[model samples]
Target: MLIKTFSYTSLFLSFLLVMTGCKDEDYALPVPKSELQNDAIKRTLGPNLVGLDIEFAYAMAILPEKGKIVSAQVEASIAGATGTYLEHRSYYTNGSGEDVGVEVAAPSTTTGATSSVTFNRDTSAATLRYFYRIPEEARGKTVSFTFSAKSSNGESVSYAMGPYTITNMDMKLDMVATDAAACYISIEDMAIYTAAEAAANPGKIDLVYLHRTPTGLTFNHALVSPAADPQYLPGVTLPAGVNRSTKVNKVWNLRDFHLARLQYGVYIDDVDFQELNLEGAPNFAINVRAEAGVWAETADGRYRAYIYVNKVNNGAKNATISMKRYTMP
Candidate 1:
């Protein structure tokens, strides 16, 4: 995945610019405020069309604050259309002229040239989350964020977050379960941000692991590289609609299966961004998963591994792990 950065230009405030309220009066004595003229806006992205509403939660936007981010999002829906153009960027600059704002992901939607009936749009929240680690000169400084939008037809629109603060780095991690016997979780990648500096680094992949419980349930993490091939079901063919089998050697998507899994990821716990560099952090990017041995008439198992979103500094964000079993139907 690629990361995108957005820049800016300016204006608008006092609520009347973007809101209408249920207050007693239409002109409520100008809510005591201050003037904010420290931001700018620009046309960073041209146009796009993707169907769906996109959100950028603070805990998920990657950036200068431990849980804050310089991120961007694409929200749109299409009947048969493949996308909705949502761009036109604005930037927040500190006194030093450094970008201290959110980065939105490059919107990518697909449509068949021959048929309007065939469309491909993505609306997943591309949230980036992180914080600045060094003695950022922008700390404590008040900055501004401006965002505009481009229509699929070439029209435009914009909005500002009002005067915002560039706070100190505060990293955090939390999980929210999404189901019963099993729940969905939104993992926050609260790492400090460091300019990619170092020598000889190929950048590694972070894997999230979901171990199975004793009752034959567990989520499958990413696939172990074939180079580090551990024992996996070598020849079991998956049935139709099945992408992988819990057969020990596949990476599965939770939406595609109905099995249980316990999630686990390494980078979320082991990575120290201050130590990350061109060589990336010092650790084995490769790992071999442990296999499960069957017992009794029923077998209890799951793949052991980890999943992670690489520190991709761009306009939008991305951090997630697959929550399904890695087995065949």
Candidate 2:
């Protein structure tokens, strides 16, 4: 198989060289540092309620698949950020040309990043996000995102991207993660770290952990670069023909999941630590929590999945739970 290596200096040169063999595959000009992610607030058609003067709503283009929506949160390269970005999210609706302005708070202080932005909307579509405003000075800079999403089923999707720019943030790329299924994202609190804090904390940028459920059925929930790999890169590979340049955005691993729910809520219970004894992986515990279960799916379906939280630990601390998800098959 042929290969290509991209870099800031060689980006231009590589582009020109690759263009020679380019096959007119559709691709987005890369999201400036951060790509648009889905907000976690769900929309429901009220059985009997007021829908008038409904200026408190907005529709997200990311329509998640049927019976999805569990513990959905957005992630990106947000390390060493100056100020906090949106963590928890909500939405509002308005007629065309009407802007729904909102004020938000950061995530609650906890092991994992989050915001106390609990979005409870009673509308068709609600906009859940920590809408960013690239100040005049901050514009034209670089950024990226580390996102997380889940369906009622145990299946989950997480990704990382960018070093994108602030200028020219307009985007239109179909390599979008969410397909016919509408995506649910909880863009919660961000830890806008200081240079001192980031420097003091080495590997903070590279450190990653996975969220688990109350039941200890899932193992290796935290994502790793590779099995038995000293350095785990949480990206996937695809056929070259499918995308001009295939990007390993997210890797969804389905383990031994045999629960009885179609569309359930998500909660964290314990953080299953990984065994860092892999030659060079430093000895450390992953950060995670379990949660309460919600809307689950039937016993049979396509999107069904089992979890794989890190069981590579010394059996010292019990994993923590936070959010739980009811899945469908």
List TM-score per model, in order.
0.17, 0.23
Please give, for residues 66-110, the per-residue lDDT of candidate 1 as tens digits.
122222322212112332233322234589988554334443232
Model 1: lDDT equals: 0.23
lDDT of 1 at 205: 16
Residue-level lDDT tens digits of model 2 in 1-329: 12354455488877888988877888779533122233232122111011111011222322343333434344433232223344334434578756464433234222223322323332222344433323334333555545455444345454454444443211111111121111111101112123333344423222123333334444333322112233222232211211111011121221212121224332111111111112232322233223211111111221111122323232332322121121221
Candidate 1: worst 10 consecutive residues by lDDT? Answer: 292-301
Backbone steric clashes in candidate 2, count:
115
The global C-alpha lDDT for each of the candidates, from Candidate 1 onward, is 0.23, 0.28
Query: RMSD of model 1, in Å?
Result: 24.2
Error of 2 at 183 (Å): 54
